[model samples]
Target chain A: MFVTPGYAQETAPAEGELQTEIVHEEGGEAGFPPFDTSTYPSQLLWLAITFGLFYLFLQKVVLPRIGNILEVRRDRIAHDLDQAARNKEEADAAVAAYEQELADARTKAHAIAQAAQDAAKADAEAERKSVEADLEQKLVEAERRIAIVREAAMKDVGTIAEDTAGAIVEALIDRKPDDAAIAAAVSQVR
Target chain B: MAEDPIHQFQISRLIPIEIGGLDFSFTNSSLFMVATVVTTGAFLYLTTSSRGLVPSRTQSVSEMSYEFVANMLRDATGPQGMRFFPLVFSLFMFILVANMFGMVPYFFTVTSHLIVTFALAMVVMLTLVGYGLKTHGARFFKLFVPHGVPGVLVPLVASIEVISFLSRPISLSVRLFANMLAGHITLKVFAGFVTTLSGLGAFGVIGAVLPLLLTIAITGLEFLVSFLQAYVFAVLTCMYLNDAVHPDH
Candidate 1:
């Protein structure tokens, strides 16, 4: 049932050897091992040596390495965080600049649209004024031509009436009337 | 026999060295102590050799132990208390590892011995008094005197304070030693029961199962006590060091 080799060894000759040694040293007292003062010197000596070595090793080697690792990690994290914050600030500035440009472009576009509309309205007004002046001059010229033609037609009608009257008088008198008579009669009729 | 729980703690000389007529022979206790130092050193050394930005599993253990003791000392004695970090860390690791090594079957428990524990406790007390006196000089006595006490009761309180202060090392040492000693004894007794009962008939075999279960349970409990005692010792050391640093309270 004893699994460990140490236990088996202890159960064998070593156990008897330990008992005899204890009996010989302590004069058959067989006292508790821990309370045995005879072992104190050796225990204290070894404890000091081992503990001192351990302390020196820890102080010199282990601690500084652990401390350095922790400090480096902390510094790295801080640096990364600072970098992230800087990048965010830059991005924010870029967004603000982008929005400012967008607003400026919108305002400029509105001004350009307004200028185009004003120019178009001015062009339309000038074209209408010129067209109205041309139409008025054409109407005046047509009225003058109509008046001259009506005067000419009235003179022609008067000549035709004189000729017709001379012919009629000649037929009644069975002789041709004189040209001077015709002219005098036509003048009396006017 | 395995029936004798005290048998496990017997220190047999592996090398019988006699120097100046004193028995300075290297014993099993010494062997385990050296083992503890080597194992602890190697663990810390190898695990941290990588020094990965993202710590590996073993590296995390080393780092956690460092931070655990570091934070405990810091919390107990504040930042200036960190000067004794090496001492506190050493005591903590040594006791912790020694106690754990004791849990292994047939392994000598270094902390189970009274002399060893007392010696460790003395280290703390010596540091406390030495550092306190060096830094604060005569003012270190203020640790024993209460701030607000009746004039008539001053002497009484101071005497009690001094007595308690003197008893610190004894209690500290005894606490660790007694716990380790008692726990190992109980575990051995239960295990011995299983062996003795199994030698009987089938009924005895059935009876042995209970103690076997109990042995397993107590073994687990001992492991806890092992870690806890180490922690308590270190923390108390920190508190005592705090008194050395600031003795008014």
Candidate 2:
């Protein structure tokens, strides 16, 4: 607020008097137009009307519309996120179910294979037992045959020794050994 | 004709209507005020009426302004300040339009008037007081007391703070009024200079060019001032309201 003293361009005949009157008419006496109190009520009233209507309009219509748009956008974003999470969870559950089914199938396949392996082992054991039984029967028959041959050889040896002893007695001293004596001597030698 | 720059500010009655000694005659200021409101209202309404997901240009501008003031309020007073968004937003838009509208040749600058701006400042101050009292009860008085003041200095500091607090409306109103008044008066004085200088024949035309260019430059500056003053007024209102909301020294 620098008050520029005064200058005159109108309603003057001389510079000094015109300057004073200019100050008197417009510069000083007129006051700052804004500070003029008489116009306060009307300006204030209009301001009140304008500002009040504006505030109400904003609060009631304009702001709410903008706010609603923003809010709707935010809610949409949140909803999309929630839906994506739900989809992810469902996918995870589906993967879990698929893995569980695979595991069950593997267990069942293993059980079936194990049963086949056990049956094969049992069949091999039975075949080995039968073969052992047949070999034992054959060994028993051969041992019996050898025992018969030994008995025949023992009877022949007794007969041959009796004949030789009779010949030797006739030739040496005109005497022959009896059957019971020969049998006793051969038995002692065997 | 001697150009009287002061005559431009004269408040002539356009439609004189006196009610019980009250001069509520519809004046030029009132006309511009209505124009500001209607223009603001219509622009906002048309732009936002679509509410498109991807905003149009006008919608973008409106939304930017809305968010700008909203953020300022929120920054100053926290989330609690959002309740006063309509108040702050309207003041900002109203003053901004009024100031800018005044820059037009032969238009009334409503914000340039002391009575108008003072009323606005009073609205801000009274709203602060009313809300402060309502929200904090008697604790709002704590704003006048400095938090870390020594016991000996408390009274002095408190008195100063109280005076500062009380002067908010005066300073707030005057700061805007003075700036607007000065800018307009300077512009008019220069405009008058251009005419007066050109009246002195060929040599005077050469002299008149400088004031003409300067007036253009100042006109641009006034445009900026128009926006800056509105921004400052709104920011100060936010700060004062912050004190009311928090009221902590």
Candidate 3:
């Protein structure tokens, strides 16, 4: 800041001069502004009035609104956070429940499938055993029939041979002629 | 130096005539006061008008002022005191601007004048009285009589309390006026010393240097005092307002 040389010089007393007397100049003190005492009463009155009005405005208007806004904002945030947490928990529970149900269904299906396989295996085993028993009985009966048929065939062959031998002997004896017929009959009888 | 001190204080001459035997020299001081009021009013109006979520620079300054007063009130009167924030804020701003503007070379420091300070003090006092009366009615008289004092001490205590009550205006006014007046006078004296010493020969130049530095330092200090004084005035006003509102406490 630049000082005006003229203004500074005007206020400066002569060097080495200690003057107690305040020079009351015609136009006011050299560099200082004049003081006004008149507005004191008015200023003070206005101060009180304005202060009162301002207090009234703050009490009635500003504070309540600000307080309400803050309270509402806090409540909303808390509510939102709480709701979000609840939804998450519920979702987690639902997911767990679904997973459990899915596992249970799989277990039930496996049990049903295992039960069907077991039944099929058991039935096949029972049928195979019954067929084996029936075939074994049929094989025994066939062997017995073959044995009886062979015995009967053997008896019939013996009887037929006897009959032929008797006929030959009788022919030989009765005919008395041919030596060859009589010898052949004796040999067949022996 | 001017012969008449009155001429120094002349604000201006409007229709140059005596009104009711009072010489009213409408001087430069008067013009500055008018300017101060207009500027203060306009500044406040512009700053507060928008009241946006994000404040403009002007608005931020105003908001800071509001916070300063709010904190002061809160400290003095607790959370309940928040209701009085605007009054305290306005008091601080008005006085602060007036005090600061007076620091300019040609401006009149309104707070320096006894009459101005007295009026301001009287307003604070009257509000305390009026509000107390309005709220407490007849019981407001009992403010002088403290409970649990001995019967013999009542009269003396009451007398002393009355005097103390009456002294509020004087104390409030004188504190501001005296501080401002003393500070300005000291500045003027130092300024004179610097100028006079600087004018002398070689050694005088060095002598002037210290005084010049001191003046610079004093000026900065005075700036702080100006703001501090305004704040003290407003805070005291709030304290008084609190007393008025809650008389029993």
Candidate 4:
């Protein structure tokens, strides 16, 4: 394949001093055998050998190694990205869940606070009614006792006044006291 | 045809100059090579100077060529082969330019010569050896011996591998130069035949017509061969460069 056209038998001058010759020795000689000049070298032959060897390298060594590196790197990168996305989603979900729990807890706390406030208000109202009832009963009893005392005192005063009136009448007339008047006064006193 | 065919290969000298026992004559071939270099340099520089995010048409083509070889190298020799991208790309450009240059009316095809193609092949061969050694050191020799081969067959296998290795430069250079030279010479010979026959009278015209048609067909075929030759050269270089990068299985 490396032959130059300048030295071809046809183009070489008949008397040209240039050492241009194509030597084809049929008998396999001692030195390197000259290439076959009668027939053109089959391009397919060299092409096949070249392609075969090339394919071998590709299939066996160069491509496999490169492909492996790329495949592994791709898988690793993809896995890392997937893991990151998953972690982000999980974090987001956790935050959402925590926020939801906090809101629920806050709502429960608010309800509890409202419920406690209502209970306290009801308890206070009941205590106020019961204490008012107690105070009213004491006031009525005191008033009844005071009325009784006052009526007794008033009766005594009436008796004393009648007795005195009788004494005064007897003295002024210079006569002894009468039993009917004394009995009437005593019955009045009783 | 000249009595000496070698004399026909020489393009007329532009300026006759002798320097220090050397025939430092400027020939048409030298002019084209210079033109090629200048043209290529100017083209790449102009196209790539303002390499924008959105490329110009020329810039796009240049980048495509770069990427084409870059991808080929990477595919053939793995990522390790990317370092040789410049060499391979330059080679592809130079050889393609040289090959196409030959198709012009008054230009010489440097690649159609043995010395040029041999030098290119030698570079590739030397590079292959140098890189293999650099990469693998003394262990590079172990490429000849497959691991699973029986010990008894070691000698046979080693010999075959060495012959194959040594033949790389020879095959690489011959394939390119031979195809171009053969096609061109055949066209020239047919053209000569046509013109020679037409120099005769009326019946000669009919005889000349056939050779003219054949020459036309051959010219078209040569054009196709030029592209094919360039492709083959580039592809083979890729394979050899592959060997350099990775010698083992």
Candidate 5:
């Protein structure tokens, strides 16, 4: 619907001038504009010039700039990605080292615990053995004393028996017996 | 008047100049060609001036265009084919910008002309042939011969290949020219209908709405065609360059 001023002005006198313009066109003043050979030289020349200039501009200036920008961006992204990968690798290594250290500490703690337990068990066994030996020695000493006391009591019993016998004889005969005889009589009775 | 759709394509001399007794007067087509070049060059240069690691919106657009063409060329021709990147990129941007400029109501479409498109196609063809010969010497003609063909039919197949190879520029040029020419004419005709109908009474005004809607739709389609044609031209150039690079296959 938008018409340029030139078109509007041309169409303004359309009722009268349109027929004349058609006549003028039919009179072989001009043919189809595209088929007209006269314009080819200028069009080709200008096309060559402009297209040549455009090609040179693009090849020399525009493309390389854009290519450089894209190349730079690609490199930057690659570098950033590489840095990120390296950082991740380092973090993974750190985590592995931490886990290894944790495992080593856990093994060391287990060994220390095992050693302490063994030492405590050995100490308890040694103490128990020493106590048992002391108890055995005390029992032997007590048995020796009891055996001596029993022998002494046995000697006294013999003496008392002989004295009884002597006292009975003395009542009857009114005399005391000899000590060696009493001992020999006691020994014969044993 | 908008009544004559062809009126828009007429090239009038802006500043007439004669060089070497030739009709080298600068026409409107030339003007728009220069405009397309300037626009493409300025846009690319200014947008990427900052060279930001993180691109701005305009810079992103410029970078996207570069990558798009680079990827297209690389895909078609591989890394060795990348030497033709400047030519391919220039052709794509020129055609695209020129077509877009044509979409403006009163602006001349440089690519709508057969001479221009033909010239552009020839440029590509010449580059292909020149590079092929320079790199492969007499072996460049192998492009016309398929890899595995009957020995008896070799001449026939090779001739057919040569014909097709020669028709590349014509087909490429005509395709773009015809598309632009037909699309613009259709749009102008439909828009002219709207104008003619609106000149009638109220019922005619109501009828004009349909064509107005169609004109809008076709204009949108034309924009798509413009970009599509540019991409087709560039991609085809890449494919042709591939043939030049690896003629045996």
Candidate 6:
């Protein structure tokens, strides 16, 4: 609902003292509080006073505390988020380091395996050379023994051949050949 | 006869004082106004005395009230409106408390009076004018002229604009005053019917039931209107202020 213009028109002329007399109708009758002409000034004065005091209190005490609380809460949340991000980065770095160290260990193991293989190959090569040298020495010794035995056998064969020649002559001409004669004969044949 | 429903609104001079032939008497209205201020102060002070990250129930309520007004101001007037947060908040608290106080048995509602609400509306309007003039200088009158209005209709539109702009105080004051007045008057009327009917015999007792139920319903509705009116007053104040702050279109 709206304020009646008639009330405004009526109160427009009754400015100063008449307003008060009308408001304090000793009996306080005939008008609604909305249309009452007299109580305007004091009510406005008190309202001004009351609201002014309230404003001061709100500005000074209440609003600042609320603003401060909200600010503190916001800062706390932001700081927590920052700390969380830093921790996450640190964790990621630590994982990367672990991965790097693991890769290095794998590489080192490969290098150890490669070095062991090379060392085994060298050992096998040296053993092969020594074994070959020892075998060659034994073969040389065996060949010398064979040569000595063959010479002995060859002497025996020469004696047997003379005997065989004597026996054959005895059978064919009823005579035996002597060792010296045989030797002379063998030399002539040579 | 039942008590006059309008009798409750009559202003009584408690400590009659006259200064310079003016009636500046201490009154029933004054008593309730002081009570509203005191109650509002006590609530804020007590609820917020000890700050906690996890708030108490009272603290939550206090904070909600703060956020409610703060958000309204921000939504209507932008961050620039924060400067008047104290005024807006105080107006809301005072009106809300006073209206709620009127709901209590036999308590006077300061907001129900036209003089009180008009005083508040004038403060808001005057602040708008004062700050508009101060901040925008003479350009503040540009509010009376709409952008894109035809030059031929400019004077007519401007005059209409000026009238409506001036009526801000009346509409603002009367809106709250009327809601409270009408709601309370309806409530009183229904309640009076119960008293009047109960006097008549058995038939009267039977007739009182309907008015009693209506009275109960209106009382509950008045409680809701009390909070709503306070909200409207504060929101309208913010809008008027926003106009002052940015009086372009």
Candidate 5 Cα misplacement greater than 4 A, ranges: A1-21, A27-29, A168-174, A178-190
lDDT digits (tens) for residues B170-234 of candidate 6? 99999999998888779888998998899899999999999999999999999999999999999
Report the C-alpha lDDT of model 2 over B1-249, residue by residue, as the tens digit. 246666456564567888889999878778888889989988888899999877889998888899899999999999988899999999999999999988987777888888899999999999999999999998999998868889999899989998999899999999999999889889989999999999999999999999999999999999999999999999999999999899984
Better of 3 and 4 by TM-score: 3
Question: Which residues of candidate 2, in runs, are more than 4 Å off?
Answer: A1-31, A77-190
Superposition TM-score, candidate 3 onto the true structure: 0.61
Q: How accurate is candidate 6 locally (lDDT)?
A: 0.83
Off by over 4 Å in 3: A1-190, B2-18, B77-87
Task: For each candidate, report what fraction of the true interface contacts it reproduces.
Answer: 0.59, 0.55, 0.10, 0.00, 0.70, 0.43
lDDT at A86 for candidate 5? Answer: 100
TM-score of each: 0.87, 0.71, 0.61, 0.54, 0.90, 0.82
The candidate with the higher lDDT, 1 or 3, is: 1
Tens-place lDDT per residue, model 4, B99-152, is: 777776435665665545666777778888898998899778887876788999
lDDT (C-alpha, whole model) for all candidates: 0.89, 0.85, 0.65, 0.66, 0.89, 0.83
Q: Estimate the overall C-alpha local distance difference test score of candidate 1.
A: 0.89
User: Relative to the unseen true structure, what is the C-alpha lDDT of residue A187 in candidate 6, on a scale of 0 to 100?
Assistant: 58
Between candidates 1 and 6, the DockQ winner: 1
lDDT of 3 by residue, B156-228 (tens): 9989988988887889888887888778777767777877887798889899888798888988888999999
**Candidate 6 lDDT over residue span A11-117, tens digit each:** 45436633564455454554555567677666776777777888899889998997777678779889999999999999999999999999999999999999999
CA lDDT of A115 in candidate 4?
100
List candidate 4 stretches off by more than 4 Å. Answer: A1-190, B2-8, B11-26
